[model samples]
Target: MNIKQSIAIIALLAATVWFWQTQPARPAPRVSFKTIKGANITPADLKGKPVLVTFWATDCPGCIEEIPHLIELHRQYSQAGLTIIAVAMHYDPPNHVLAMAEAKQLPYAVALDPSGSLAQNFGNVQLTPTTFLLDRNGRIVMQKVGVFDLRDMRQRLQAID
Candidate 1:
């Protein structure tokens, strides 16, 4: 094959690998979430329900954009045993997170990771809007680092539920 054709094939392969689902074999980490409303949550506490833990910062535009969608998802699936947690990054000030959560009227739990230990436990997540979708068994079935497809998420939730 010519050089250009070979490069195109390599690029296609790279894209396939990049977009592949990341289904971690390990069970959900023994992490704890301290919600802004003074609620304590542990992974064990969320057993038998699907959970979405999104690592985001108040200053991240993408994160801000997804707030509405996240809220919608929670409203639709919460009664069906889906638990969503929006975790503010360690760098995001608590006041800013609280204000934004209140302004948006987030129905899901809003958590703070001040020590960044929660991020560290979740594969050292450093990117804003990194989301992990866990099954009822606490196994990570999906890990998306950017904007996730709403339709795809809904389908996955249905299958898991």
Candidate 2:
């Protein structure tokens, strides 16, 4: 390669290394909530377990569409140290959230974030169906803002399991 080409390649490599070294690690947020069943739930409650925290709203079409997938994931992984919690957004009416939870018969714990405290804890989650996957050590391993791939999510959960 020419000297100029070599110099450019070296600069590119340096930039890549710098970027990787400087990027801050994202740790999972410490979150706690009260389930609709009046049971208090927290990350501490599921220590050593891989957890999926999903923020959703009753009015969100995407959120509704993802419910079945979430339910399936919970069923397949709950026995393998996977904990899934569905948190209803504050904008969604509490009654509606409760009614939908019952109608859907969600197999996992369903919580209502009435004051948005839990949402705020997770980077002020404003988008419906925002999901966070936490590792067994409670680290934020992945965050999906919209629709997420179920297969990919399953693979990650399997790794943590």
Tell me which residue pairs clash in candidate 2: none
Best by TM-score: 1
Off by over 4 Å in 2: 1-25
RMSD of model 2, in Å?
A: 7.4
Residue pairs with colliding backbones in model 1 are: none
lDDT of 1 by residue, 1-101 (tens): 99999999999977874665554445778788999999999877898999999999989988988888898899899999999999999999999999998
How displaced is residue 149 in candidate 2, in Å?
0.8
lDDT string for model 2 (1-161, tens) is 99999999999988885564334447778778799999998767978989899999999999999999999998999998788899999988989988999999998988989899999988888888898888888888887777778998989888886
* TM-score of each predicted structure versus truth: 0.88, 0.83
Off by over 4 Å in 1: 1-20
Note the Cα lDDT for every prediction shown. 0.89, 0.86
Which one is best on lDDT?
Answer: 1
